[model samples]
Target: MSTSTGGGVPASRFLFLGTRAGHSIADAEYEAICHYAGLPTSRMDRVRLEEGPMPQIDLDRYAGVITGGSPFNSSDPITEKSVVQQRVEADMSKILDEIVARDMPFLGACYGVGTLGTHQGAVVDRTFGEPPGTGHIELTDAGRADPLCVGLPDKFDAFLGHKEAVRELPSHAVLLATSGPCPVQMFRVKKNLYATQFHPELDSTGLIERLQEYRHAGYFHPDELDRLTREALASEVVHPQQILKNFVEVYA
Candidate 1:
């Protein structure tokens, strides 16, 4: 597919698929990502997959797709999942089918790892869930050579907290980066489709805000909110955002 908009108009902006139900939190996440991407708020389209059915978006109208983290875990049994989670998962499956077939540009963060891994037949469970905090991630040989990892350092800190992760990468997937707790921190499918266990779009500020909102959501002890905020604030996470900026530059 052509990545440009014909007739001298600027290319269509990317779509950010957010699953967070809280309007404030969802908007904050989307705005933070767009800020780092150097794209105006107007250049990005935000969709809340949790609110209702996935809208019928024309792929040709977007340069790529970005899916954010969520409270839902793909490892949960069908009977345990909420109706919204199930519906969102089904919609994501159809979207990924088209993305993979066309090799369209995509970036799935946090919960996105579970969604894409499950769809690709990978083993996704809570076997390697990391706590809510900053962790160091190292790029593998494959990751070093990947276009998205071009300007990134071999090792860097990133915000992460997940209840489930990919236990085994899919047959067609290439492992990109790895963390101490999560073996499959990042991976790629056919180059364009990428999934990461960390939140590439988040900074210390963004993560701190999330910590406050999700403290009671079971990511961590409610009393540890203050300590968690301090730890996240102390961490220097500058390189991870490069991945987001690079994706837009390369594909948009």
Candidate 2:
């Protein structure tokens, strides 16, 4: 992992806020995102938010912030959440307040939807959770013209599995993509702040690994792990990665 002395000015760097507590899972998530962005891992400074307080990052120094998925769900009752989860969520609120105020470039995936949604006063609940697998995503008319959706077909497949999702897009956000099961698959706050309920940085291999690692974490029945792996391997998901690449190209 690339280390940074906190409180430095943001240069041409990118900040990746990852909340995964497991070292291997966190590393894989960060590496996969950097790979898709066609950026060397060193160019993206990683901060494991679950470890402690969110670092004091100078937003001006980084091109943008890219947040990774986590086991933490925004819909969980406050009392049910772990101390780390609460702290991370609180930190995100402060960070997002600044990011939104400036319309700073940001892309959040999976758990990101919850964070951004909660911050914007959108309804986030378990009503829209999806099981583990590739879901068919359809771009709205607005999505088709969005720069991030450029070169992506109107309909494509993306990997997703979450215990909660944005029930309704925040008033100021634009809906970009939607799946049959989840209405708010992707949305943008202001112009530069984006969030996706799916994992655009993930592919079949990465999904398989995540499923294996989180098998007992309630995404799906533990007995179906092998079956889910087979399904993920067989699915052809290609365009989602372009979103990450586009975010890097447009902002970085």
Candidate 3:
């Protein structure tokens, strides 16, 4: 039972797990990630638990759960997997241990920052990663007084290409934002449990059309994919579509 378009509407329901599946990117980047998580593409239903066999929701049937981005690497090297990507990383680590033991309302991007930052114990590595452009991000002051990033735009535009991050931050995470090459670009493990190493449901013409269809599938450097798709198509958006309308106006 996969679904997400503006959810069932009694004010609770937004499940969308995927280690990569909504036609595997580019249906307008899965309709700009279910239209920035308020889900409205006629109800996006498909729990593509990384293409294995998803069907175990029940976090009160969801009012939040949005995981995306993947090339499969919850810190990989499991003999370079293929048993359905090691059973979708063991069914997303038992659904991220029931979404960090019920601190739900999760939002994960780029492999969910290595599957909820390596299941909340942090220390997932690739050594300070964040390649593949759209640099310049900043917002710590508790992420500018976060209401899911208050008043944004002191510098924005994020759509990173990961290799694993969050080298340390799990004692019930906090660290709102930072960048230079990535230093936990966003985090939060208590208040509605958020996460984002950037890719807040992409824009700029759907991230330059998935960077021209994954630009040889390597992020950057196919001779810099025509200068990173012309600076992700002349940059300047620096992200701010209301931060998903303040996460759908904080539970609408």
Report the number of the highest-lDDT candidate. Answer: 2
How close to the true structure is residue 231 of candidate 3, measured as C-alpha lDDT? 78
Q: What is the lDDT of every predicted structure here? A: 0.88, 0.90, 0.70
Query: Please, what is the TM-score per model?
Result: 0.95, 0.96, 0.31
Write down the RMSD of all candidates, one decimal each: 2.6, 2.6, 17.3
Runs with alpha carbons beyond 4 Å of true place in candidate 1: 1-12
The digit string of per-residue lDDT tens for model 2 on 20-49 reads 988998999999999998888878988899
Hey, what RMSD does candidate 2 come out at? 2.6
Residue pairs of candidate 1 with colliding backbone atoms: none
Write model 1 residue lDDT over 107-204, tens digit each, in one string.
99988798888988899998999889998899999999999998999999888999899999868999999987899999999879999999888999
Best by TM-score: 2
Local accuracy of candidate 3 as per-residue lDDT tens digits, 1-252: 223334345545466666554473734555677776566765454466655566655565556777767767767678877788788877877877877777877777777778888877888878876667676778788777878776687667676777678788877688888877787888888787777887877766777766666677655666777787777778766465456557656754
Comparing 2 with 3 on TM-score, the higher-scoring candidate is: 2
Ranking by lDDT: 2, 1, 3
Q: After superposition, how far is residue 230 of candidate 3 from its true place, in Å?
A: 51
